[model samples]
Target: MPGNDVRFLLVDDIRENLVALEALLRRDGLEIHTAQSAAQALELMLVNDYALAFLDVHMPETDGYELAELMRGAERTRRLPIIFVTAADMDETRRFRGYEAGAVDFIFKPIDPVILKSKSEVFFQLGCQARDLARQRDEMRAMALHRDQAMARLKAHADNSPLATVELDCDLNLRVWSQGAERIFGHKTRDMLGRPVAGTRWLSEETIHLLRGWIADDEGQDSAPRYTTEAIAFHAGGHEIACELYASSLCEPEGQHRSLTLQVLDISERRQAEAMRSLLIGELNHRIKNTLANVQAIARQTLRQSTGLEDFDRSFSGRLQALSRAHSILSDATWSSAPLDDLIADQIKAGTLDGDRLRQSGPKVQISPENMLRLALTLHELGTNAQKYGALSRSGGEVHLSWRCEGEGLVLQWQERGGPHVTPPVRTGFGHTLIGASAGGQDGSVDVDWQPEGVIWTIRLTQGVTPVSGDAPVQKALTSVTVTEESLVGRRILMIEDEPLVALDLTFELEDVGAEVVAVARTLRDALREAADQMVDLALLDGNLGGEKVDAVAEILSRRGIPFCFVSGYGPEHLPAGFRTVPIVQKPVDPARLLSVLHQISVTPVAETL
Candidate 1:
């Protein structure tokens, strides 16, 4: 009824009758394409999309009945609505033939306009509704296909994810289960589908009761919502596994209930890790307390047994402090790993080197915490020997320590020079037996070369050292800074820093050296703005800022032919990709060191800038 305007095709041999029918339907906006003969009417049918056709039965050639039969034979127009306008005198046999030719209705001649208008309107509304319904059906089919594809993608991700997933209906029947569920629960989906969840035997009684209670409370509610619970479940192999279950209710349109979806995940490993972490904390506390008590006992007994205060201080206090330093080194490494250089530094500070007498030179290397403790004791004994008769005893004498990576291992050399003349002792001391025996026990070898110049000791170790990779290339420090006569006075440098303190410190340091700090940007937004507007000669960038990386700034500066350097606390191994070619200075940088790096960049040729 909403779109009731019908388009009609009127065919007749007389033009006067077509005009009379058109006048009657003029108020309904009927579009009438009229034809003088049936042959012309058939031609009009070929080109137009008409809802209804009115024909005159008593034509000379190709009468209305014949034309209707022809129209019925055409595949394109076979279903078109046709009504005959004829004289009442037509016989019953001719009427039967008209019906057989696909005439929907017949009108007597002198053609009543009122009957014609009403019949045409009905067919037009029906045609419009049928077309609308067809379009709606096509749209619904496309939407269903798109929704199916989305559901398929979601199912694929759920199956592939590490977290286990399972779906169950309101009656607790298993519906959908993912491969991850099989791995976590050790149950195959084929054996579990359509089975009651409580009968699975893997679900604990407590978890089953919780699920039942939640469902019972939400009963009779059309808007079935989501809920979550965590509990322990048993695996197929009879192991108790902690799992977190995410459950949600599925419903059809019009608020009708369908089923429930459950996602199960095994959290057993995480739970066990938490429990073990608690035990480790308690154990660490007990060990530290016991170690302190042992040290106290040793100190009191050694002091009481000594003849004088000097002997008590040398034997009891110093040795306990040396042991304490070893413990500190182990603690700093989180009891997982330690740097050999750090262990050596800590031990030397406790005994002979006293900070000023220590001279360490080596590439960075990591050692296990267990080996670090053993090496700390060995080094403490060596330092004691040095303090008594070696280089550490004299003011000018010092220990020259160096280590390097060998084939699949590490070799550390500790040589003493400029102290007492060296010679092999006739009798091995307690320290000599411990160092030599411990090194050999760990599948390592120690060599003591008593040269006339000094005591040269080399230890080769096979374990607890990590070889440097390509990402962390070796960088040797310059022995001293080389300065030029040319001053960097009045040269402008752009400072891109995130921290206010570091930026302020750099600004002061740069101004002190006769260089102007043109602009300081604390974020990428501000830096880009300054770069676009200001004439920046050089840029000093921090690698990480608030949610933005410094690579973009570097790229912008590079394109503009402005030189820049990266100042970061991260090691060379952690630097951003493509930043290897860019110059970098590690932080906690000395003012003089920063100045030297900036000066080098300023003097570098333009072609060499990265």
Candidate 2:
């Protein structure tokens, strides 16, 4: 709305000439004003801004040249462009006179319409451009004012923030120190400004060295704009604080260091939380591996006692369900402890035992997670036995389950009544073995009384009970598995693992296939030494050895041209980027898969294996 101010002036004594010029120049975004006399033209020019004006040379009162000279004398119309229309033949002397009178150009009596429109269009475009430039200048001034206000607000916020804001020069002299830095480091801003940072008490010597190294390395290099690092800083009270520093630097065009801005955030609480999360993850990993090992043991034992596939399915599934139920209870309590009554109640509900025919009594007692698993399995075995051949087999049968604390120990009794006569077993079975194993790894005893009416089982534990290791010995008929590959026989192998039970199980599996284990290294130190010193044809490398990555050992084995495979509790993401192509076996290790991988490694060429 503000830029549409284009107007043109045409002055002539002849009405026909003025009409013709107006018709030629008339178009959109322009206003044409016509004046029949010099006086009228001068008055029109005084009121309205004009882009261009045309004058006739033979006006009655004032000629075109005199009108041009008069317009040039005026303040508003001096810079305006003027063209003259004349019929008389012009000599060099007359042309010079017209030029001196401020006439820019002269058009003949018969004017060309093309010339008139093109010349007027140029002046119209120039007017539009001037308006646009003026508008842009005003907008830029407004933006500058807003930017100054925003910078002021940002400075106030930085000064009051909890994070320490620091500005340093190329020589590491403090240039700007906010109030936050004063509060955190016990130094006034006025005192800290213009001081060298090397003598500051807030930063330790080691931290200063680290920061200086970063700055020096980046000084003359085409470095990134910003960087982040962690450091141990001291508080005003002399207490230690973990600080996370974010730094950005300004540089000259030639890569010379200029200035730097640093924002230091106290991350002590975040660091503690990260450490706790890591500990919880490691503990969870340990427990999961143990659980898998226990499952393997249960499957193996179940297989040994099973008479057929159907019997194995029934027994193994029931045992696993019982274990799952115990895990559920532990999970609900965050794996800290499980109440004995809750365990018994869940078992009774799962076993579908009649509550009216049972007498159950026990004080509130908390058991460890591992012991709860063992107790759950023991209860499953007893319930299955009772439903099959013991008291629960008859309608009139009854069971009495009671427990009480005895001097820092606990004693639980399971008795059966109102059933057929009982006799002692000639040999122990899987049920008997599991029930006996309920004593766990503590000082405990299992006693049974084979009365004429029924049987009674009493379990007493002298200390906190823990589930037995999966590698524990058991007296049972052994099942043999035939070796699938003859290449594995008599081949030497090196094993790198930390868990004793897992290593032992692997050792037995390798031995069963006639492969000799040359060395078993549990730590990174031992693993590196064994890998370099041993002359084994192949190696079994675990991805993690006692919380240290085994990438170094893998590299050594690769350099020696030894074929190898990895066994890890974690997935491929845990593997080193360089050794991701190597074969990996995850826990709990499958005997067949481990053997298959070993056979492949033994037979394949070292170049291909690597």
On TM-score, the candidate that comes out on top is 1
Pairs with steric clashes in candidate 1 = none
lDDT of each: 0.74, 0.80
Cα-lDDT of candidate 1: 0.74
Off by over 4 Å in 1: 1-5, 26-33, 36-51, 58-61, 87-89, 117-165, 178-189, 233-242, 249-259, 265-367, 373-377, 380-388, 391-610
The sequence of per-residue lDDT tens digits that candidate 1 reaches over residues 139-174 is 899899999999998878887887777777667788
| Ten-residue region with minimum lDDT total, candidate 2 | 473-482
With candidate 2 superimposed using the best TM-score fit, by how many Å does residue 24's alpha carbon deviate from the native?
A: 35
Can you tell me which runs of candidate 2 are displaced by over 4 Å? 1-148, 152-164, 169-201, 214-225, 235-243, 251-259, 265-281, 406-409, 451-453, 461-610
How does residue 212 of candidate 1 score in lDDT?
Answer: 71
